[model samples]
Target: MGSTSPPATAKCSSDWFAHKKKNGRISRCPIWGDIGEKQNAVDFEHSFLRAMRASNIEKKDFILEFQLYLTHGSPANDWYIAAAAAASDWDAFAAAFWVKFPAPKVQVRMPMEYEWILTELRLDEAKLLEHHPDTNNYMWKCNEQANWKDFTNTIKAVKKQEIEEGVEHQKLLEKTKAEVAAVQKGLWECIPPMPETPSKALGHSLAGMGFADNSRGRYGRDQRGGYAGRGNYRGRGGGPGQRNSTPLTSEKVATLAWNVALLPHHPNTSEGLQAYWEQLAAWAGRWGREAVINHEKPVLLKPGMSPVASGECFNCGMRGHQGQFCEAMGDQTLGFREREWRVLCGHNLPHSSGHSAQVNNVLDDDFDTWLSGGLGKGEGSTD
Candidate 1:
């Protein structure tokens, strides 16, 4: 008779089982117990079954093989052995081994909602969402780990800090307001009229006063274009002096002086106007003594009355000058000292917006001559 053939599934030889057998247990068999990875257990099961089939091990012997491979130290290992012993067929045994080890259950954790976090924190959802954190982890911690206790504690701490800052700021503001009130008390009558309305007009009034405190421009120029000093006025050009110079006649000087003196007499004069005249008086006290004396003379231009002795620049109405000449004729930078005199003295002179004094027409010839000879394309033009 021919030798019996091995089963088609039999791949392992008796020699392989001989190597696996050591003493009583299968020594070289893979252990299934304590497998951390589910895939590892599955892979071991596949290979172990294939080896058993190839070796042509009987069903009863398969249990012994499982006992050797699925050894101690695992709950699943114990269950797998019992499953293998009770299994009636190969398919049942295979199912038992696999049931003990399945792919680790996939754990899905949902992210916390941003709106829920904002609600828990008692923050404005609209505002907080608009801001961003430096890292996703930090933001996650804020959203996930922050509890009601933490939220309440943070709110209390922030409120305390804000209150302290507000108190300090209010104290400073009150002190400033008090000091301002004191300063304003003395100038109550002098302060220009405050607007009747308390909204935009009040803001403008406060701002205007602030401007006056900071610089000369606020008080220096009036709505009517009156300036207290020499620099700003482009004087009515042309006279007996430099044709470019706005020289005042005897009549114009008298008129201007009266207007200035009567400004303080007006019904509702502004503080700036009052202050301007006060400042001018102070200046005159220091420099106008001799000019005052010369002014008393009946004829300012008459011979033998030294213009220098008069103590004022009659050409510009500034102190310390002779009537024969004025610095204003060529220099535009002479400050508005002469203008103060002109405004105070008053005149029917044309407004700044209107045409220049008609006197310029008559002085055209004199102006041309002076421009050709005196003011060359030279020194003063550079400015």
Candidate 2:
């Protein structure tokens, strides 16, 4: 009789029945079975409470079912009735439920407003119920008067300050713009006007005479003959009787030198030279009577071997002498002698060849006149 069935076949049938019974445990329970299979005592309690709170179940019905589950280890029939008694709005129960149970899901649903309740009550619910006896009462009061008047006032004050700062910034920008405009206006008024254009007739005349360009007209060989063959000279020019000559002291030399240094680079004639000398004589008189003066020497005029000669006369329409000589020889037809003199002195002229003789004659005569007055008669003459 014991050998009537196979041992392997009987064992497999018993194991299958055991597995089926174990899987059916959650579905057998009424409270958890509605959502899914019941997991354990702790998990069942958490799910039941969440459903109740979300439904805003009345407090009395919640307590009744809560007690039943705590004491009997199972949810009662009509659990939704208990949920309705606990709260008016299911959302409001989220914070209250978290404070009591503090599960992860409940924590997520809890409102941030609960922080005020925690701060005012100063309670850590996890520590112990005894430590946070007044937490519930504090939360109830906070809920009743939840107006943010003080916070709104602080925000308004900050906004007003920002507006005032913006106004001041605009005013500063305007002030800076006005100051810049005034400075620009002053600069415009202070600037000098540009020089006028040269006349076309003057330009054409200069161009025809090969004196139009500065490079062509410039005298290459020191026309004054004063610094010829001299090495590069810096500093001021010197005066008469101040060079390496007899009976000239260094103090007297320096006094004369200072005066001559102020004279123009090229004096057209001997009269211009004599005028400079007179000024130097006055300086020397003052210097000789004053404290020990350091005198500089006069720069010597270098003599060129070229014999001084005159060109064709534009005044007399002749080919040998200048206009001054023409005038001296009783020729009044040369009427542009003064204008020619200005040109010979390096003053810019409108006509070049037309005034060459007249210019040269005026310079030569002026030089002779000045020499006769200064060295010959001791009467300082000016051209």
Candidate 3:
């Protein structure tokens, strides 16, 4: 039975040292501890009462011997009096001991006071509940208050919605200026006017007699009764025997009766032949220049004419020979003298004293071979 004492093993090693001396040390174990030793002993008694009232040591016996040397562990000369009381009472020792310590069941935490929960919430809900331990429902206390006229009625409702959008943009600019003055008074009552007549109102009152009073002038009623050139005084060329004899047929009525008889044969006119028979009866009653002065022919020329001969070139105006014999005037040369017809026996020779002596001896031997050589060798020879 004495051998049974082996079971004691030194009384199970003194009951495992009395259950680790009532479960305390091995670094205060919670499974191999270091679990922020009671939040570092409440941050060493809130940094030893914030370094003994910032060294002014408002002696409550030097802040109870500096909270008994930071609750007995902050040692190194109590961190040199909690670093000289956090350099002179750093804000009343960070508001009485780092915001009145106490909370610390610790899983590692210390930065306290969190600016009193960012002065009670709203800094974007206190930066989204700081690192949330449900941020003590954003704990506050540093004076609280607000509502300045609900922020001045939200800035007077955004300046009364920007002054009612500037009075609806000035009533849409006065209804776009009354619809553009009623579309310019309905386009000035749709246009119209241009009609006239009584010989186009007496050719716009004898357009100072040179006629351009529109419809290129030739005043009133002439199909064959009277007024046109006055020849009928009603009888035997007086008023009714009616005969200024119409007849003229047209080279634009002899060039509008030679431009209305050169506007009254202006040699300072003393009624130049009665203003050339009233501008040759108003250019033979409207531009048929009395049929090219009764068919004697040749008139066309008017586009800045000057001396343009070779068939009078209105740049080929009358459609035939002009632009200098126009093979579109490519090589230039058109001089023009050739109108010869002197037949004699076959009869056509007329144009004033028959000529063509073999075309005037071939134009006098081409003007004596172009005055001896200045040009004739194959004519103005460019080669």
Candidate 4:
């Protein structure tokens, strides 16, 4: 009201500046330029009130002195202009100023990863609230949940999730255990346990091989060789690990024990054993020089192995060769089992014995060439 005659501008009566003198600080209250880029109208208002309060300026007359707080073009100046026109009391003007440029609120740092938290982690605002963080980093949660102030009013909503996860994990473990048990039960049904006694196990194996129960004593040996005289098959091997030597498989151990038990009664057992070796030697001499030279084991044939690769000969009922390569029989294409299954299934699979199939077999010379390391089918070939 100091310049009412000129209507130039309003200023604080002399009393307003007295607070500075009383506090022994001569600097005026901070000038809010409302300068570049800090467009925070809200913060400007809070700062102005804070200074007024700190200075102990009586709130009733603070409005008249408010222009002292602002510089040109500041939101404070704008509020002061409006306030000067109609504000009857300082408190009334302050209330209006607050409505226009409220206090600076704590804003949420606009969250980026909330979608992943919401969808992938399956967390909602309620779940975030449940974590009950102590004194840091709720700006995101404040933004996500209603808003900072109303949120101050809304966000108990986690111990429950742990209980739910535990339940699910327990259920999965039960299902896995059930599946394993079912497979184990099937295996038990298919392969009964080996016989407990050595003799009984040998007898069972011989029976499976179509030998009579007493025939275990009759096979593999008849005396007359030095081997039968030695009578002890298990010797102390040179290595410590092999000291108590036993055959690798339980079945072989059972068979040897059965034969050993009958050793006293079968003085002629070595004769059969010697004859068996002679026949094996003759077979190797005729058809498998590799066994003589390299001491290679005989071919191992398993069920469902390729018949061609295994050299299974239906004509001679032998596995070391295909019928085409069998010295004992003529060439054939379809193996006996293949032919049988095909006929049983009523399929018109062509027989391998036909001229076309026979033509496919390499000559014996070609097989010999292949064995000498030249490339060929390396299998069943005719003379």
Query: Highest lDDT, which number?
Result: 1
Per-residue CA lDDT of model 2 for 1-383, tens digit only, reads 23322245432243432332344311222233223433344465566566446445455444433433332333333433455366565454434433434333333536667876678787444332222222321222222222445434544656777989989999999888678656755665676643456554343222223122232233223445332322111101100001122433556544554533443433537665555445444433333323232223222111111011112233332233223223322222222422122222221211234322221211222554556557635465444
TM-score of each predicted structure versus truth: 0.20, 0.13, 0.12, 0.22
Residue 226 displacement in candidate 1 (angstroms): 99
Instruction: Give the C-alpha lDDT of model 3.
Output: 0.33
* Number of backbone collisions per candidate: 17, 13, 23, 10
Top TM-score model:
4
| Worst 10-residue lDDT window, candidate 1 | 208-217
Each prediction's RMSD over C-alphas, in Å, is 28.4, 33.6, 37.1, 28.9
lDDT of 3 by residue, 292-347 (tens): 22222222222222211111222221222212222322112211210110011001
The per-residue C-alpha lDDT of model 3 at residue 132 equals: 21
For candidate 1, write residues 328-379 as lDDT tens digits.
4323222344433333222222222121112212221254456556554673
Off by over 4 Å in 3: 1-300, 307-311, 314-383
- Deviating ranges (above 4 Å) for candidate 4: 1-43, 73-75, 103-383
* Weakest lDDT window of 10 consecutive positions for candidate 2: 233-242
Candidate 4 overall Cα lDDT vs. reference? 0.40
